[model samples]
Target: MNCEATKCQCGCDQETDQQKYEKIAEIIAKYKNQAGSLIQVLHAAQNIYGYLPLELQRFIAAGMDKPLAEVSGVITFYSFFSTQPKGKHTIRVCMGTACYVRGGKKLVDRLEDILKVQVGETTEDRKYTLDIARCIGACGLAPAMMIDDVVYKQVNPDKLETILAKY
Candidate 1:
């Protein structure tokens, strides 16, 4: 949740994010009028700001002398890059053939209903972010999902509330 007292509603302190963005801007400036630094700069920016919004993307584009279209294209091309804020806890649902066939989508639906947010979105309280992964590899244990680093194999959609409560 955002601290209403802080000027920046983001998780990080306002001054700290300013320092970080300034440093990142410096890095982007190094590649001014250069090419092929879009990916690297976006990666660094995401690392610092968690996600890239239009304002920040504009900042990066101007700093690196790259077109906003090019930067936005790269960001959209890669599913790994997120334009929206992620929650404190990330929940990934596997959608591989095995898992899909074994009720993975159902589990995702259950999670969405429980959290009241669609896939790739964070709950209003910023407690959890739901994501869909092509495969989390545990095919043998089909219908797998993970919260942060902990993997839950053979998840039961009916028990999501109990399972999530442990977190």
Candidate 2:
């Protein structure tokens, strides 16, 4: 299957999402003769598209009269930027010193078992992606994990079964 198709198997049109590319094009046209439009266009494009694909970057580069290499360089340099699509649900485990000492590793293990996927991998259904971060500035809530933007604090191995059951 071409998962990259602009339309899904159920005939759900994703052109609404692709329309974001056209919106970017409009923004580019508006700023076609302006200076420093590269960064501005990149921001608008990323905002609309979620992530900047190579083709979008090329379009922006051409619109701004900039080289693809320069646009590519800027995209690569920013940690906030991404080339890949993100999962619907983002699961982040905190491996900070406090969380780590408070059974964070065990929590991670349990999550892996429940999700049937290793860290940094998406579930087979593409609903969730497991990620590990060094810290989330939540030392007060040690042994923490986050699903989407909701935080699960003081997580324990035994709670894994019940926690996953809700999902």
Candidate 3:
């Protein structure tokens, strides 16, 4: 693959579409006959391709000798599987009771405005994907937010910009 044309999330080296398919095919061959291995295969596919698009899902279905509906159903059933490409970084704003009462809605609104993308949408530049979380278990620090795995406590609209800049 031309690294100059498309860069993978890992930022090491990008594989051509053909190479990606071959790798996934090999994975399918490894576990095709294993009962209840669809989820595992899907997980590996997502890890390699980033997100499970309809086309890739179709390919996987055919390779695994499963119906498209079964594959699509699994993808939809799991929130972790995404049909669209995700941004390099994911930002989740907590919206639990404590957070909501502590200006979580305000933070969501501010993030929408700042990122120019609504909840579950990625920025145009693909730098960030915005999401809403029920809670991040930081009730004591209400209005908490997380960028990837790092949680920010007592987040406020005023600090959103600075927090985003660090990313």
Candidate RMSDs in Å, in order, are: 3.1, 3.9, 3.0
| Candidate 1 stretches greater than 4 Å from native | 1-15
Per-residue lDDT of candidate 1, residues 32-119 (tens digit): 6566778888988898888999999999888877789988999999998999988889999999999999999999999989999999
Task: Highest lDDT: give the candidate number.
Answer: 3
- TM-score, candidate number 1: 0.87
Model 3, residue 69: C-alpha shift (Å):
2.4
Write the residue-wise lDDT of candidate 3 on 1-167 in tens digits.
Answer: 23443345557767856668788999999999999999999999999888898999999999999999999999999998888889999999999999999999999999999999999889999999999999788999998999999999998799899999997
For model 2, how does the per-residue alpha-carbon lDDT over 29-102 read when each residue is reduced to its tens digit?
99889876677778888888867888888888898889899999998888666665556787889999999999
Give residue 114's error in model 1 in angstroms.
0.5
lDDT of each: 0.87, 0.80, 0.91
Model 2 misplacement above 4 A: 1-17, 31-34, 105-121
Query: Where is the poorest 10-residue window by lDDT in model 3?
Result: 1-10
TM-score to native of every candidate shown: 0.87, 0.72, 0.87
Rank candidates, TM-score, best first.
1, 3, 2
